[model samples]
Target: MSALVNMAAEVPENPLVPPIPELVIGLVAFFIVFGFLAKKLLPNINNVLDQRREQIEGGIEKAEALQAEAQQVLEDYRSQLADARHEAARLRQEAQEQGATLIAEMRAEGQRQREEIIAAGHAQIEADRKQAAQSLRQDVGKLATELAGKLVGESLEDHARQSRTIDRFLDELEAKAASDSTKAEAGR
Candidate 1:
């Protein structure tokens, strides 16, 4: 106890040095301030950060859902495109078949028309030939009658002689007509 009193009496008091009591008071004040900030400010900041994290996560979930929906729509559109392509191909085939059928029908119709025209022309030619033969027969008969009158003028008055003359004239006319018709057909 005497030694401790001697050490205390030898220590010098300085205005620049803080006392132990003052140092202890400053430590207590700092602890209180830091404790208050830690309990109140840090928790509020954490809550705000947590809220932001939740919002960001929810936004990401919504974005993912939207992307999935868009993918489904794209798939559906691709399927529809394929179906449309098939339909177009089917229609093209049908159109080609129809066009070919129509062409065949038109060709058949044209052939029929051509044949009908040729048949009509042949019939007209046959009728004209018959008319020409009839006219030729009349003219030839008149010429044969005149020739017979000159060849056997008085003999033709007899019935038997007239019959013979008529038979000979008809035979000659038939031969000439056949020869002329053959020549005409060969020329054609």
Candidate 2:
């Protein structure tokens, strides 16, 4: 305790004030370090900062170019879509026209076929009517020949005589039938 007290009494009166030589040495050392940092480290730091700035600008430029390319691609896609829609509409219209043409052709063909069928039917009916008329004439002639043979006591076996008799009888029958039809109409 006595030694601590003696040491305290021997201590400098102004402890906050350093000696002049020490202050000068400290100032010299600080200047040397500051000068070295300013000459060497400061330039390296500035170069690194400039490189980083260039990299950031280049990245921004690349991003802008990519955005422009994407915009162009989107525009092209939209144009193609519009073209496709127009083509689809054109194809649909063409198909409708073709369908209408096909329907018209089918109707024409059907009409032609119907006309041909009607003509064929008329021809068939005429042929059938002629055949029936010929058959009725033959039947009436045969009946008349049999009745005449019974009445006159003779066989009508001669072809020419029989044909003549049948024609004469059919002509008289047609005349009588015509007169009868006229009388019936007058009565009506």
Candidate 3:
């Protein structure tokens, strides 16, 4: 260690190397370059990096807001769709019930109308039978009076003769009516 130290001290500095004036010029050039880079290039680079960071953050916030709004809209639409379906179901049920009730009422009305028509027809037949019986009785009575006048050799147009003839005719008519009723019963 002592020999290495003495040899380093005895060695003379090389004159061929850079002199003090050259060294000073080199130092000055290096300081000027470093100052220019710090003032212009470094500030421009920092500004560009800051702008890029701000743009990225803003884009992330906008995406989150759009996602939230879309979720809200989707929920609202779903609720509305459910409400519409429920309303449609209610309307369908109501329409079906109304149709059933109307059908029942129509059936009842038709039955009533049919019964009324049958009753009217029966009443008309009864009235026509009574009218025909009265007309037949009048014609039969006139013929009986004529026949009695011929058979008895008397004027049956007189009241006493007419009464006797009608009495005989009624007795024969009652006997015939009884016989016809018995025949109808046996047929049934």
Candidate number achieving the greatest TM-score relative to the actual structure: 2
Ranking by TM-score: 2, 3, 1
lDDT per residue, candidate 1, 44-101, as tens digits?
Answer: 9999999999999999999999999999999999999999999999999999999999
Kindly give the stretch of ten consecutive residues in candidate 1 with the minimal lDDT sum. Answer: 154-163
Q: After superposition, which runs of candidate 3 have C-alpha atoms over 4 Å from their true positions?
A: 1-45, 158-175
> Could you tell me the TM-score of candidate 3?
0.66
For candidate 3, write residues 90-137 as lDDT tens digits: 999999999999999999999999999999999999999989887877
Evaluated against the true structure, the overall lDDT of model 1 is: 0.88
Candidate 2: 10-residue stretch with minimal lDDT: 8-17
lDDT of 1 at 164: 62
TM-scores of the models, in the order given: 0.65, 0.72, 0.66
- Model 2 clash pairs? none
In model 2, state the lDDT of residue 48: 100
Error of 1 at 109 (Å): 1.4
Error of 2 at 153 (Å): 2.6
